[model samples]
Target: MEKDSGKHPLFFVTERLEFPPVEYTNEEGLLAVGGDLSPERLLLAYQSGIFPWFNEDSLILWWSPDPRMVLFPNKIKISKSMRKVLDSGQFRLTKNTRFDDVIDLCAQSPRKDQHGTWITQSMKKAYKRLHEIGMAKSYEVWEGSELVGGLYGIDLGHVFCGESMFSKVSNASKFAFIKLAQDLEKKNYKLIDCQVYTPHLESLGAEEMPRENFIKILNEKN
Candidate 1:
């Protein structure tokens, strides 16, 4: 994957846990910039397709952007008014119970033109230590005992890397992203990364692709 004389890679990773080969990223897909999100460097940065976006006043910024923005969990797109708001069950989905109140309300939601929050506070204690070693998760959309909507990510078995979402009312984050994409398409989960690009996740069906075919589906072993 050669090409790296333009200076970008910088993850000494406390003496190398390694991560500089997504074609040695640079033209804005950054690559590395001082790592330490340690859940073994965020599971070796999503097993090398890489992640960790910046902006709690910058500096810990690694990425692998290219065309990325995935979704594929059985092509998730249920529009007829979101299937009548999931058959009007009136929101009450939960997984991983509360995940520090759905990542403290997705680090205090609010990001149209963006101003702050890349879910910082050491990325919420390094994703609550990758949700206490299970590889990070959280999808709550309750409305009974309150907690409006939710989302959280990084589940890389077959990739579920979402990362952020919030909503206090109106459709409650699209019913917590359509019940986490129909429960990761009943566990077959080939993808969901949605790393960048938004028209609200391209109207629920996320698309984009090539970063060398998403690192060839992140070097599949699932």
Candidate 2:
């Protein structure tokens, strides 16, 4: 039987675990296959510019769209207001601190005009494992003793692959992102993988690069 003919209607699993070419993904870059979110699978997926995203009860969906959105840490724009916040030093920033808490908060926090979340329970557990193994890291913004905002993602070689972020206070998420970019810059990290497009990310200096270009960069550094 043809490979596509035997695959699950909504998903597929590789017989020997190989990803389709990034270009073979649909217009949205949703390429083939569903596999467990084993650490090895997650790492391989990300390294190829694919990531798992799905709602509860659905099989894991992997994607790697064309015109990928990314941020070069040194290229992150700091607006006047954000610069003021940074200058004030009102919030304390820490790395890999309370990561599980940060992920939980992200899952619970509501997005404006959106019901539910994509950060399913299984994903949370998977990433938490990634964190424990030091492949994933969180950047948290704290107000006094409270954790107000943060983001998390895998750190593969020279890439900081952003998965999701949430803000509990105004500009909190932005601040945490700024700090992440700054720190990544210090570490000589190559890119902040935003995965998809968003006006908010554009305002912060993220731009689109073709998927092929992205994979080339990723592979070059790996």
Candidate 3:
């Protein structure tokens, strides 16, 4: 979606190693394009409330959407059915245990809103590197020894920026999400960064905050 910089977005060169002010983004929240996904760049992006989202066929696209969707760690809603699923002992949860598996499953999982996957090969590699460095985390839902569901994201100390999640069984992902929120609440995280909206997340108590406020809060905390 490239056009003249004045009318569209900034051209992000890898050697320059910096991003344009997110305020320069066009209406779609695309701030810049064409950067490498080195761990340094990725970490900085998350810290600045920016994230890379592009397909293999496109240049690396960066975004910082306004009215960001976030979930307070203490405000996660657990439906009665979810509670029943939890109480049933149908699954067990673990953290940072299988990030590669989780991300792979998420990439393979179909989405109703789009065709193909945004979690490209480069994205997966970058995130796995982040996981190796303790900056990325995953939550695994296990039914017996089988991994049925999970989610992965970058953890910026006080806020966890969720990337993607997938479930092999009904409510497995939801169970993992609720458990994650409960645990993070106990650990004093400010919120979970959902980035964009999804009705599924909204149903679980995620809400929108202004972009300026979201960045301010992200900066103020971690």
Candidate 1: regions farther than 4 A off: 1-30, 35-61, 70-76, 79-85, 92-100, 104-121, 125-140, 146-149, 152-162, 165-174, 178-193, 196-204, 210-222
What are the per-residue Cα lDDT tens digits for candidate 2 across 73-175?
9999999999999999888999998899999999998977778988999999999999999999999998898888999999997988998898888888999
TM-score, cand. 2 vs. native: 0.93
What lDDT would each prediction earn against the true structure? 0.81, 0.86, 0.89
Question: What is candidate 2's local distance difference test score?
Answer: 0.86
TM-score of decoy 3:
0.95
User: How many residue pairs clash in each candidate at the backbone level?
Assistant: 0, 2, 0
Error of 1 at 27 (Å): 13
Q: What's the best-to-worst order under lDDT?
A: 3, 2, 1
Question: Each candidate: RMSD to true structure?
Answer: 14.2, 2.4, 1.9
| Superposed Cα RMSD, model 3 | 1.9
Candidate 1: give the clashing pairs.
none
For candidate 2, the 10 contiguous residues with the lowest summed lDDT are 1-10
lDDT of 2 at 179: 91
RMSD score of candidate 2 (Å): 2.4
- Per-residue CA lDDT of model 3 for 43-70, tens digit only, reads 9899998999999899998998887999
- Give TM-scores for every candidate, taking all chains together and pairing residue i with residue i: 0.35, 0.93, 0.95
Q: Which scores greater on lDDT, model 2 or model 3?
A: 3
